[model samples]
Target: MSKQADSSICAYAYCSHEQTGYEKHFFITPASLLQHVQKLDELGYFLEDITCMQVKEGFLLTYHFNRWEKPGRLALRVLVVEEDKTIDSISSIYPGALWHERECYDFFGIVFKNHPSLIPLLLPPEMEERPLLKSSEKLRDLYELLPGCEQVLHAPRDEEFGQFIKECSQKGK
Candidate 1:
């Protein structure tokens, strides 16, 4: 589906530490989650949203970004099976994704490749099981914008950190 029609795609203020141009609207998708990260590495877009999703089949890995050198917001996503919840680490590209990946692993049981250290960032040492997979209530609020959604600022943001299952539901299966 086109991002404009997809409720999972939303427009927001793209803020980043890098010195970029004016913020631009961006689309979010489970399919493009991973591709966008790879694109950012190649295109020099600053990291925007680095989070994962819970899908019926499994999980969706993503990294959102705003282009500092260009003019656009980028969102990347990748779907992973429950049995093999893993993906390549983007630390090589963004350097900062290292901690983000670790946080994903700590809470959602995602495995990152070639990470210098993928230790727990927000979970206790005794918490062995994946917290996000444990319950549906701990999901992030999923959202997408309709075309011409100039009133994007009114949407309520999901602040809960343990909303893994909610992220996956945006798949619209």
Candidate 2:
């Protein structure tokens, strides 16, 4: 696990020799999202796709980047709080992200800050409700959804997750 000077940007132990998928998955704070994506761009990672999932914690935005020459993919996951469904745009670093971001916005209602234009990509302008938002009762734990897979909270540090877990534990009291 590696981290940048900014504690918000952290790389976890998602990668392993036996793993056949992405090389790494980094948890990034909303503030460091742009910088992290920019660094990946500088390292020659091409934007492959951007996927959003409505999780119990919030909205999980995963930016998939790959290098053609090296042939590996790295995903940067950013958790946007439900109340603040926004994150910095990586369109400046990877122009292709523009469309992907727009699509995410259209479906997840996640605003891409400073995006050239954040109009809906797949939905009509008249649409107001984001169809992707799931009800709390239907929301499932990450582990339950993906059996046998490791689950890592998208917090900057494990301690932060610990705090959140503690708070959640006390909520029923």
Candidate 3:
């Protein structure tokens, strides 16, 4: 028989007013991050979604929960440094989270610890850059020159589009 990597565990639940009384439930601390995932087998909450957002500080892990009686589901967050963008995986909690986490990893380049399979859920094989991280002007230029450039070239010339172009141009892209 093989021994599991974890030997200790802790669990805590806290409420946040910002969650509007739904209680932003979480089982935190480094110790529990691994073992508590096993408890989820008996607890019944299933992983719903995983995504990353680029903020002023760094990428934020957003883990959504479902299949639980608790209202507002749950969101377990983990922060990573801009340089050391990685996290211990919770795949043991809900296997389905693997796909979601992989997609997040693909786009944001965050690591999921202990994930059995961590691979791209999107993006082509030949892609050389992370498209979402591109500057606004580069995005505009790419979209403006996409396959159907002719339709985009003749679309309604709204003032909002002009404003977008002006911003991109001023940003020195």
- The best candidate by lDDT is 2
Which scores higher on TM-score, 2 or 3? 2
How close to the true structure is residue 107 of candidate 3, measured as C-alpha lDDT? Answer: 81
RMSD of 3: 20.5
Residue 77 miss distance in model 3 (angstroms):
1.0
Model 3, 1-173: lDDT tens digits are 11222312111122333422323334233334455445444455566677776653455565665544543444554445578777888776677878887787778777888999887778775665665564544333322322222332233223332343355346642
Give per-residue CA lDDT, model 1, range 31-84, as digits (tens): 333444564455456776578667554575656666454445444435566787
Please write out the lDDT profile of model 2 over residues 1-173, one tens digit for every residue. 22233333224533542343655565656776776666566566788899999877788888888777766567777778889988888888888989999999998899988999999989999999898889899997654653333345534543433343355346531
Minimal lDDT window, size 10, model 3: 1-10
| Per-prediction backbone clash count | 14, 0, 0
Greater-lDDT candidate between 1 and 3 = 1
Cα distance off (Å), candidate 2, residue 17? 7.2
After superposition on all CA atoms, how large is the RMSD of candidate 2?
A: 11.2
* Residue pairs that clash (backbone atoms under 3 angstroms), model 2: none
